[model samples]
Target chain A: MKKVIVHVTLKEGVLDPQGQTIETSLHSLGFTEVEEVRTGKTIELLLDNHDNVEARVQDMCTKLLANPVIEDYRVNVEEAVQS
Target chain B: MKKVIVHVTLKEGVLDPQGQTIETSLHSLGFTEVEEVRTGKTIELLLDNHDNVEARVQDMCTKLLANPVIEDYRVNVEEAVQS
Candidate 1:
């Protein structure tokens, strides 16, 4: 099986309110060195094959996993070990 | 500045509830080929330098970004293109 990891994040120039909230919360919890924080989403897909998985996963990202206008995605593929 | 992207996901063999939700939602929305889906989190940090950043970021992942036992993380570092 092929395992693909997908990372979905807001474009660098976009603002992230959820990240801001986490930063402030961290500061309150005594983590003072945090300069900035941006939060996103991670997804993993287990497929029987890797061939053409990239295009399908990208389609998944655009169609439902992410808000394409403000967010971007990176996908990494690894071959899963067989038992 | 150093930009680090952290991907946190459920360890292999662990069940993912959120991913199942998304998969079902997608099926309802007309996507039928999706086999399985697993979901996690992504975090981006912009640091002034790379020195000692990995340790700090890993600490951040352990302390705040992810749950140690059930979740695993992989970090990628990239130099931001300065304008």
Candidate 2:
């Protein structure tokens, strides 16, 4: 099996209210050293071993996993370690 | 400066409805080889250079970034590359 990890993050310059809120909260909590925060999504997928897995996974990201207009995604494919 | 990446993921055995929905959607989209899916949060933080930054980041995770009861988090601290 192949393990695919897709990270979807907002494009730079996009307003991330959630991140801003987190930063404010952290400051209030005494973590004043924190300067900036950006939040994103991490999706982990297990797939059957197959050819062209990376390409297929990229297509998945383009079609559904990420919103291309405002967000960017990176896909990492690795050998699934059996438990 | 430090670039801290916190990855918060649901504990193993926890039900992930969002992941299930994504898996179903992928199948319908003809990505039939997909077997399982899990979703998580990725928080990226930029912090001022300071002593004990890793410990501070871990505290941030415990206090605000992650729910220890149902989620596990990993922190990666790297030197912030200047633009």
List clashing residue pairs in candidate 2. none
DockQ of 1: 0.51
TM-score of chain A of each: 0.85, 0.93
Q: Candidate 1, residue B64: CA error in Å?
A: 1.7
Predicted complex 2: DockQ: 0.91
DockQ for every model comes to 0.51, 0.91
- Across A1-83, the per-residue lDDT of candidate 1 in tens digits comes to 66778888888789899899878876776656667889988777766654577787777778888888998888887676452
Query: Which tens-of-lDDT digit does each residue in B1-83 have in candidate 1?
Result: 67878888889889888999988987787656556888988777766654577887787787887898999999887776342
Model 2 clash tally, residue pairs: 0
Pairs clashing within candidate 1: none
Runs with alpha carbons beyond 4 Å of true place in candidate 2: none
In candidate 1 the C-alpha lDDT for residue B20 amounts to 92
lDDT of 2 by residue, B1-83 (tens): 78999999999999999999999999999999999999999999999887999999999999999999999999999877563
